[model samples]
Target: MILLDLFHYWVFIAILMMGFYTVIAKQNLIKKLLGLSLFQSAVFLLFIGIAKVDGGTTPILHPSISTEIFSNPLPQVLILTAIVVGISTSALGLAIVVRIKEAYGSIEEDQIQSKDESA
Candidate 1:
């Protein structure tokens, strides 16, 4: 019963772990970047989840609405900034991977390492 109340947190943990595992286990540079994006998405989910409040409304000042509980807008604002940053970062990472592929002739980590060692 208690676990059901915190389902979002569980989902966040699962996604975070999956992303981390992919980052650690995948040998392809593209896969690693995808994993990083997933990791970033999980973090975004966490922040959004934390910002939610039960019986809370948007932080707007109205004359009639007597509700005192209000969800924090700061986290949502920060998450928006983070989302833009994350997209920029992913684009940069993909650009780097493309360059790596062109230079190394392969995107796999092991192959790149072996080639580097031989050269």
Candidate 2:
């Protein structure tokens, strides 16, 4: 069935929505960051899934394997770079949260906003 073939895509959508919901529904900065990471992971999964090819082999040339499909490696490479960037972004976000906690004494969005309003 088509649904069975696209199962990974469905999983990707589910995780993406969960992460998006967490980011929107959670007030805590840490939780939001975690959700963002989850969202990024889902994107990575989607890309990897797309890069997969049925009955594909590595791109290495082999005369013996004349009839072979090769999966595109570009997406996998780009995802690797994205993963590194995501890690750096997460570290920066965490650092910013720490600074916000230090300055506002709270990481909750509403608390920070109220303090800012009162200031």
Candidate 3:
């Protein structure tokens, strides 16, 4: 069972890496940023999935619950923070793209470079 779970995690990580590769390999700035965001979200999902334990409850401090049977909240908290950071990074990236498009009149990074060269 643990091996199966580990396999699932590795599959997700592979997918995430593929997304990263697409981001790096693509010339369109918008497409690259989209791929990057997808990669980051995948990572966040991985973290959340790993934190879940079978038959576990949310990490809540309750009077009846004992320490041995509760789920951990640290990973969730970490993921949440990562989500916010990702959002901010994506927003900043979009803003930069907008500025680049405004200046270059194109969103394709290579095309922009080519046009600049001819000008």
Candidate 4:
């Protein structure tokens, strides 16, 4: 079971690494945004995954329970906030990208750099 749990984490780690690579290697602005989104998702996955317990309940009061193992809700709330922020940021980034595409006629980083340098 422990090995399985570790394996699950490896999947999230792989996703994170892939996103990092995409952001570093890709020259297109849209691709970079996608990479950033992927990275954020991986982070969310890891955080929520770690917050889970083998036998945990929600952080609510129970009258008859002798031994209560309630999960922490702070991470969940924080992650929810992060997700909302991430979405808003992503939308803003894509809007910027669209404007960039309209102004520059290209969304590639190298192309934009060259255009700016020539101007």
Candidate 5:
């Protein structure tokens, strides 16, 4: 049962692995940034999944209900912050890539390295 439950996470795992492989194996700076975005998305999915509860409700109190299970709000708050950070990181990375392209005339890592060596 436990192992079967873990199967639900296979897609996220696959996406994470693909992102890592893309970042590592690709020579294009734009592709690497795309992979980084994918990686961040996968992390977001995991955090949201972990924050879910089987029968949880929002953190609220009801006068009629004596027993209530409320989900933790901390993880959600943290994930929101992470999302903002991720956006900022991606924006900065893309700006850098643009500058590199302008300077090197190509976004490929090997090309950039060769240009640097020749200069």
Candidate 6:
């Protein structure tokens, strides 16, 4: 059981690292935005996945329902906020990428700056 738990933790960390590295290392503006978005989604997945209590339910409550199957709702609420923020970030990032592409005829940061410097 302990080993299994450790393995799951390692998996999450690995996913996180992969996403982070992509976000940091990508050259294209759109690729970087995609990496950032994936990283955020992985974080939200970790949030929701880890928040599941043992033997928990889907957080719905009804009088007809039953003897205590309540799962945590806080994580769900927080993830909702995260999703909204992610959407806004994606929109902003797309806007920025469009502007950068327009300004330099390319999205690579170095190329864009070089174009600016040359002109």
* Model 4: lowest-lDDT 10 consecutive positions: 64-73
State the lDDT of candidate 2 residue by residue for 41-118, as single tens digits: 999999999997888877678898775799879899999999999999899999999999999999999999999999
Candidate 2: Cα lDDT at 75: 93
What clash pairs does model 1 have?
none
lDDT per residue for candidate 3 within 15-85, as digits (tens), equals 79988997989999988998989899889878888888878887788887775666678889999999999
Task: Provide backbone clash counts, one per model.
Answer: 0, 0, 0, 0, 0, 0
Which clashing pairs does model 6 show? none
Off by over 4 Å in 1: 63-66
Whole-model lDDT, model 3: 0.87
What digit string (tens of lDDT, one per residue) describes model 1 on residues 36-113? 999999999999999989899988899877899999889999999999999999999999999998999999999999
Candidate that scores best on TM-score: 1
Cα lDDT for residue 70, model 5? 72
**Which stretches in model 5 have alpha-carbon errors above 4 Å?**
62-67
TM-score for each predicted model, relative to the true structure: 0.91, 0.90, 0.85, 0.85, 0.87, 0.87
Clashing pairs in 4: none
Better by lDDT, candidate 5 or 4: 4
- Considering summed lDDT, which 10 consecutive residues are worst modelled in model 5? 59-68
Which pairs of residues collide in candidate 5?
none
Candidate 2 lDDT score at position 17? 93
Runs of candidate 2 exceeding 4 Å displacement: 62-67
What overall lDDT goes with each candidate model?
Answer: 0.94, 0.94, 0.87, 0.90, 0.87, 0.83
RMSD of each: 1.4, 1.7, 2.1, 2.2, 2.0, 1.8
Model 3's TM-score against the true structure: 0.85
Clashes of 2: 0
